[model samples]
Target: MLLEATDIHKTFQEGRETVHVLNGVTLSLARGEIVSLEGPSGSGKTTLLSIVGCILTPTSGRVVIEQHGVNAQHQGELARVRRQYIGFVFQQFNLFPALTALENIEYALNIKGVKGAAAQREAQRVLVAVGLAERLHFLPRDLSGGQKQRVAVARALAGNSPLILADEPTANLDSVTGGQVLEMFRALAKQENRGLLIVTHDPKVRAVADRVLKIEDGRLI
Candidate 1:
């Protein structure tokens, strides 16, 4: 399994009350598989994605990636796991406005400790993979919504992470562009053998996934 999350639960203390987000949610993703997580608003979709992406520590339960059990309490270890095993894509492109498409990917690789000429090569390779080769030097401002999202995808793929976690990746694009992006995701999982867990509310996205899982009231159903 590329990713396995078992009995995941998250609770937040809000003043005097406790807000229970995820309750014993269990799921797994295998290599070359695309899983879509669907849920309503405030149904803990993003919260679960955050925990799986290693940005937030779960209140309980375990997350294992590539056979290594993650130590959520160890910040350093969490960072290492995130850098070495997981890539994240968000609803917003989240590209630096001043950076070109290639530069944006290069920056992501730099965070993974890849820099200089090696970073440049990997950045170019992934941009081409996402069909953004012609827009390599275009700044975010110069690119369309789909192009910017493609750059974000390339950034996520730059380090060759085994698992990709995407939260509402197509939320900001039109139907045509969203379909194109979904196809690219399918190619990445099917051809590149990357595991993808996409959190989305769109039925079209669920239709494209190899398996569609729904969450309600913090539990997977």
Candidate 2:
């Protein structure tokens, strides 16, 4: 398994009330597989992704990636894990307005300690894979919604992490563009042996998934 999340739970205290957001959610992801998580808004899908991605600590749970158990209390370790093992694509395009598409991908590679020609080459490679080679120098504002999301996807994949987690990646895209992106994810998982987990309400996403999981009221059903 590339990733395993066992018996996860999350709770938040709002004023005097305690809200339970996740309840014993468990998931397993393997290389060469794509899993789609579907649920209504506020059903804790993103929360689960956060914990699995090592971004947020769960109230109680265990997250293991590549045989190493994650310690939520260790911020540095979590950061390292996120950098080395996981790639995340948020619902909103979090691209820097100041950086061009190629530069954005190069920045992620730079953070991973890749530099100079290597980073530039890798960035160009992923841009080509996303069919954005011609638009590599364009800023986020110059790109369409689908194009921007593809850039986000390219940024995530540029690092070549074993696991990729995406939250509502196709939310703003039209059906044709969304399908293209989802197909790219499927190809990556199958051809590159990467594990892909996507949280989405789009039926198109579910259609390409190897497994479809539905979360309701904090539990997977």
TM-scores of all candidate predictions against the true structure: 0.98, 0.98
Task: Report lDDT (CA) for all predictions.
Answer: 0.92, 0.91
| Candidate 1 lDDT tens digits, 1-221 | 99999999999999999999999999999998999999999999999999999999999999999999999999999999988988888899899999999999999899999999999999999999999889999999999999989999888888899899898999999999999999987887678789999999888897679999999999999
For residues 68-107, what per-residue lDDT tens digits would candidate 2 score against the true structure? Answer: 9998999999999988998888789799899999999999
Worst 10 residues of 1 by lDDT: 184-193
Best by TM-score: 1
Off by over 4 Å in 1: none
Q: What residue runs in model 2 are displaced by over 4 Å at the alpha carbon?
A: none
Worst 10 residues of 2 by lDDT: 184-193
* Native-to-model Cα distance after best TM-score fit, residue 151 in candidate 2, in Å: 0.8
TM-score of 2: 0.98
